[model samples]
Target: MVKTPLFKSLPSRDRTAAKKLVAPAVIGIWIVILFPLLYALYVSFHDWILSQGKIGEVNFSNYITVLKDPLLLNAAKNTILLTVSVVVLEIAIGFGLALLLNNKRIRLRNLYLFILLVPMLMPPITVGLIWRLLLHPDLGIINYMLSLVGLPQPIWLADPVLAMITIIIVDVWHETSFIILVLLAGLTSLPDEMYEAAMIDGASAWQKFKFVTLPLMAPTILVATIIRMIAALKTYDLVYILTRGGPGISTETISYYIYKVFFVFLDMGKSSAMAFILLAIIILMTLILMRVMRTAEQ
Candidate 1:
């Protein structure tokens, strides 16, 4: 039976109307999200007071001053350190856990997954406060346990290096579950025929994993890592609550530094400039990830 012209063409008008209705929603979304970002960029180039009438002129002075500021540079460096350390550790542990849990023998898999996801679901401020209590030199559980073992407890928060280390540890703890869940999904969805073929070809377990598993799982791993990096780089709540960017700027990551500039110092211009710099860095990294992974997939 041949379809009538009315039947074929009736949907076109509906789709056009739907697109027209969606246009305003799309524009509103752009306005809400992109407007603030573009405004922040504009503020970064002008020396604008938070309470001023208008930002008179735009210049690169804010960027220049921020770049020349040693404290800002140190904060950027520390932020990079925090992001890299957390991502590396989380990926390793997350993948390891995923591989282990992927086994058929693990009982209560759903329960384990639920427990692991608790940290990621918790509020950042709560995690910070909880870790602060745990890392407390005098009354914390960690120190108390160490004392029971007849060891002298070190000041975890007071010491700069220890403080940074603690932040990284907490970050890894919180985010590894996300990686685990994504990887577990990827692992379970994998075609078993590849592994079976490898076994038929007399390939060892390690070789099958190294060649077949890794390549297929690369896309999932890349997505997880990118997400984790983005979250880690923007980490502010944990550092803020735990150290307050204290111990003499030792654990001062970029987000916390921006908070300090905007709130503590009331330097919106400098803060905006620093924010734009961070935005540029993240955007570049995302683009690079896309290119490398696209090529790899091909």
Candidate 2:
């Protein structure tokens, strides 16, 4: 057997050309990512109100105030709940469906996948708007159908708990498609030789899944989860269009709350501070996912 080196060194001319090709991307990153991040950090430490139309004096206690606010705490709690629920639900459902479709016995797999992916392909804001109208108490098709069936037609986004639950259900429906797509790709790309070996060993279906599939699929699952979790943490458009974090802040997530502070309340400094906090949170979660992926790979 022969093994080949993964990387090949380019000739000097090719190397120079490669550097030139990558320079624009690096510059774009600096302009798009680094500059805004630095500006946000700078703004976070100062007292700036949009109404004032100026970045005011530096207020070192900005973070302290943000941390102390009860509403911030509430929003953080809501965000955590929403993120955890949606991620877990999406991953479980997506993986199950992916496994089902991955089986050779499954017919019309592409059609099923196409239908499932429709929600995800649509704009998130559009999904939210459609769901909002569908769940409307008076005129919604959902409630009208419920009335026809003699079932109770509850206000989907009116009550606190129900509003949160409504948001979660809608989110799961919208985001699960992404997880399925990613995990399905991973499943299809897995080496068939390993499965053949498992079958030769007389491994039971459950055992094959537990020992063979799970271990191999762990990293892919973690990657999908990390992407979804980051997006969930920054969720605002859906919340904005659907509930607007209404029903007495029941569905108010950190991102939506931050948006309100930044735009509605016109508190740029506080909003920037909250945004940084959320960014730190996302980075921490990504690091944790990376660590888990490393362990799984090992």
Candidate 3:
């Protein structure tokens, strides 16, 4: 056989070192993340109950019951609606804000950006509490302002439609900063030469944005959308603090429903089954988003 180059042996050594460096992280992940997921999966199939204090027979009854539950169905529908609406609105508002901040004529752009990011920095529970006070029908500043403007003050959290709208609004306020930050970074990184080329071709503002800005920003947009979508799907803290899935479950997302089942009903098996279903849905959404991102890249 021909003598192998010393570089080939060096490559093998580097590979071994790389594996050694990565092995601890991989094992840690298995212990911290994968192990819990596997345990949850195992428990999901069994008739486990808090009160029973024992794992019963393993079967699909938990999943079957969850699927047939009308409340769960409603919760799933609400979650989908909330996720879509919040993501769309967040993208729109965030992009607009990013564009405004990117304007060369704007003064104090950094200050404005900082102010907008403050809401996102706040804990969800704190944001919810603040909004709850503002949304209070009786003494809320929001209603007071509406009254000043001679507008009728609707029950923000008590009305089903309004409750959902309120939740969406709160979510948008808290999360749009994330989208704004991502889009602004994408905008800032875009090569100025592309805009100059478009200008040389006599492209209008709308044309440049439609053809150049959007295509380049597509990946960033997809990332922000997917993150916000997943967060919206698993929304609980704000909902719990603000409405507690009240107004007859109008604002109850699947996560909140699962919490109620797990803690309130103490149905560990059904809750785990629901949790797994939610996980599957989130994974499916993530895959779909990745596919879309790939298409956009192409």
- Give each model's clash number: 0, 0, 0
lDDT of each residue in 126-229, candidate 1, tens digit only: 98899989988878999999999999899998999988999899888888888999999999999999999999999998998999999999999999988888
The worst-scoring run of ten residues by lDDT in candidate 1 lies at: 3-12
RMSD of 3: 4.2
Candidate 2 per-residue lDDT, tens place, 125-174, comes to 89998998999999889999999999999998889999899889999999
Q: Which stretches of candidate 3 lie over 4 Å from their true place?
A: 1-20
- For this target, which candidate reaches the highest lDDT against the unseen true structure? 2
Clashing pairs in 1: none
Candidate 3 positional error at 212, Å: 1.7
TM-score of every candidate relative to the true structure: 0.91, 0.92, 0.92
**TM-score-based ranking:** 3, 2, 1
Off by over 4 Å in 2: 1-20
